[model samples]
Target: MTATDPRLLPFSAVLSSLENEGAYAVMAAAAAVESATGKPVIHLEIGQPAFPTPAPVADAAIAAIAAGKTKYSSPRGVAPLRAAIASLANRHRGLAVTPQHVVVGSGAKPGLFLATLALVRGPHDHLLIPDPGFPTYRAMVAVANGTAVPVPLRPDMRSFDMPALEAAVTHRTRLVVLNSPGNPTGGVVPLEHLRRIAQLAVEHDFWVVSDEIYSQLCYEDTYTSIASPPGMAVRTVVVDGFSKSYCMTGWRLGWAIMPPPLAERVELLLVHSVGCTATFTQEAGIAALAGGGEVEMLRREYRKRRDIVVKGLNAIPGVRCDRPQGAFCAFADVRSFGRSSKEIADVLLQDGLVAVLPGTDFGEQGEGFIRLSYVSEEEEQREGLRRIAATLGRLRPVKAVA
Candidate 1:
């Protein structure tokens, strides 16, 4: 453990950086505040679903465990689960995939990590990601020694800017990540925009890594898969999981659909890295796919909570929040207050006993905003908004003029 010891040498730069990710830092700070204050902090910082795993999935897992299914599954996952995922993707997303094209990993997060590892050859390759995007994308690219170029989301906060993407992409760009109903902003990309991006990828000969974990949570519009575009299937890797859609976060199961060869490579990566996903978890995933009604109920409930949070946030004097078309988060514009997003978020946590993530945690573009996850119960969501409104109202005298 001494500094001179070989083991004390610097760890992988990317792994070291992931330890300090803004979201995890804020969540830890929130926990500390709650502990010190002896009062429940309103948690709008984490993106986990407030609900428990659905009964069918949990039951299936328990049964599998009791039936001695504790052994290892294939790196591509159990055959039944892979077939289920393939069928679901083909039917819902209009993608033609088979079990052979599916690669299951521990979670969608790891699926993304493995995809980047398999796709990026070295530091010379570029991975184009969205600014104010899910931080994991950039972290994964870095872990694989790929240069990450962040393309800023449009000002309206609804979708990616085509012009910006066009400017960023080049022959050296190896991958473009598409997160519809994106994290932090909750802005769902339009289908036409995706088609255009798909065309651009085809022209540039870059791969597309589509994270569709939130596809089942859309409210105003149906979710569209970028892989559905003509001639894009072979070039697109669709990553999704049972966590968000089925309230199975603790289960840690996810799948990806890619061309057969790339899928094979990713499966190999999984085998070397984690060996395989847990067998019982894959069984639970099968039940989740069969029990689709649970997600529908969740979507309905989240829509109601989303409405509450958006309305409450927009009503604040210096805050303007756009109603997110999908996902369980509201990105509120707090630039009118002039304070840095971290300052505002800190004030909310310490003074208002409300914990929300600052926009800066996402990227530079998130500097003056805050992301509020409506993933808590309806009552807690309302209370969180109330605290935030009061906090912002108190700052109006000093911050409004800025």
Candidate 2:
């Protein structure tokens, strides 16, 4: 018999057409180039913080390991860690989150995936997500075999389209995913918009999954949780983690807050999937909650970097970047240059030695934009901007008229 074709592997259909997160793909490309050329590549592609893990958080995890606390934990998470997450949410977001409402997991991502799987019950179920939003939102819904409908953000780039959202909701709409201090754009959804969304969810009787991982990094506006609204706590699932605020990326721990029954369902999913988040990592999360000072220092530094990157991008010719109200990214519009974002990103990487994610990879509406993460060191951030400006500056001299 002839040799079988290698392409005929038994992988799921989702794997065949997966839309990967562009940031990580760019970061990996940058790494390969840096390694091969033995030159440092300025990384503005991903949101991995430049700071080391907070000392207190690291120490707590070490102590737990030294004390032989490495065994498997409850699939729902450790008791103290769940309580800590609940308390922090209540204190910070004015939500009535109790331990009963908390479900800890390996990271916010897993909880998000589990929530989507648990909520999106059938192939006919429809899930609403923001266009040009986090790539994982739609991916998870697809993995759950649900229809993913993207609601585009307003042209102003500050808020979502309320009328579009109202029109999108129906009995088939099972879940709506929201990201505040959003990824890539760093635009926070205002309280009024959130209130309207809450009202819609109440009327349509659909669940809202709010991904508030960047809640602590808001630069201008106060952070608000949709669950805090009256009659909304029971209908919202909050996904948060220690990766951003405490710079505990390697720790791999995060949690969810929702109604007790929903939390239990998520916990059951965790039980059947991965056993639980590592026990010691949960200890580290406990320390992070206790050490508020570390998070505050990080917030202050990210705010400064945010200002620098926004200002630098705006100063460049053919580029106009708005100051992000929250998070550590600056999404710059480069449509004026009449180039796809990927082409610009390639030029920056090859000529300028700077890496950024092309926005079009996020969704259709993300075309003509590129997302730069300002989570690098201050000097590196400045140098990356300089290189970006210098390279783009050369293009303005002969740019084609639109």
Candidate 3:
């Protein structure tokens, strides 16, 4: 056989079904556009916060390194950090968790993967994920060799379509992933919806993986967790991280809170896979948990950015945007222009030099919309809005007068 022969090796068939998050792909394409044209691309594609890590958080990490706390501690996490996480959970979500229930990982993705792997046995298992949701939930289900059932969002894009979600659940359903203040759309699941979901999980005897990375970024008066409802704390895995809230994306610190039994299993998974998250990073997480003021400031700034982007998008001739309740994205409706979301996104990138994601990148339900992250400065966001309006104006649809 030749060195480059197709039959040289066998790869897992599951690899063929896996799809990546669209943000990275858009980022790469934007980079190429910037390379080809001398103009800098206005970035609205990526979800990362533009803010720097707070000084106290950075100082904590530095102090830990100076104290030589660099070795692997416990797969469950260091004692102090775990305790801090549990305390934070209790304060925010009304949970009575303890350090024993916390398991730290490199990022929320690892905990999400481990939770799916633990619950999903094989292709017979079904996992319900939000349509117009974070892509990682589906990707993790694929990794676990399970069937992913997409639950479409309601027309308002504020929460799941309960009728659709109710119809999607079956005896084979093993898990459901929930993301409040969710990605792409910035929709916060209402408390009543969470209550209904909690009831379903109890009735169906399935697990819930609640991704709350954006919990601190909520613009609403309060944030609710599905785990807060009765009987949910035992079945729910609360996956959160310091990346989005603390601007510690590069630090790679995230954690999951679950029942002690499952926490043990997930810790074992951590031990055999990545071993443990960096000790110093966990120390930084402790500081982040204590530094509440910095987080509130970040949240306030994000709210301002959200207002600016939503208003600007709404002013465009064919574009309409709802004010996002939380998170830092503007999901703009572009169906009036008579084009697919991908086509609109491409025109925005190529013609306007603005980078954004097509809504279909989230799921089929996102067909007529596009997602733009408002994580950049207010000035940059306005500039991106200008480009989108100018580019899309050329394709504006004509009105038929009666």
Candidate lDDT scores, in order, read 0.88, 0.87, 0.89
**Least well predicted 10-residue stretch by lDDT in candidate 2:** 393-402
Which one wins on lDDT?
A: 3
Which residue ranges in model 2 land beyond 4 Å of their true spot?
1-8, 397-402
Could you estimate the TM-score for every candidate? 0.96, 0.96, 0.97
The digit string of per-residue lDDT tens for model 2 on 203-247 reads: 889999999999998887988998988889988999999889889
Query: Which model is ahead, 2 or 3, in terms of lDDT?
Result: 3
Collision pairs in model 1: none
The candidate 1 region of ten consecutive residues with least summed lDDT is: 393-402
Flag regions of model 3 displaced more than 4 Å. Answer: 1-8, 398-402
Of the candidates numbered 1 and 3, which has the greater lDDT value?
Answer: 3
* Full ranking by lDDT: 3, 1, 2
TM-score of 2: 0.96
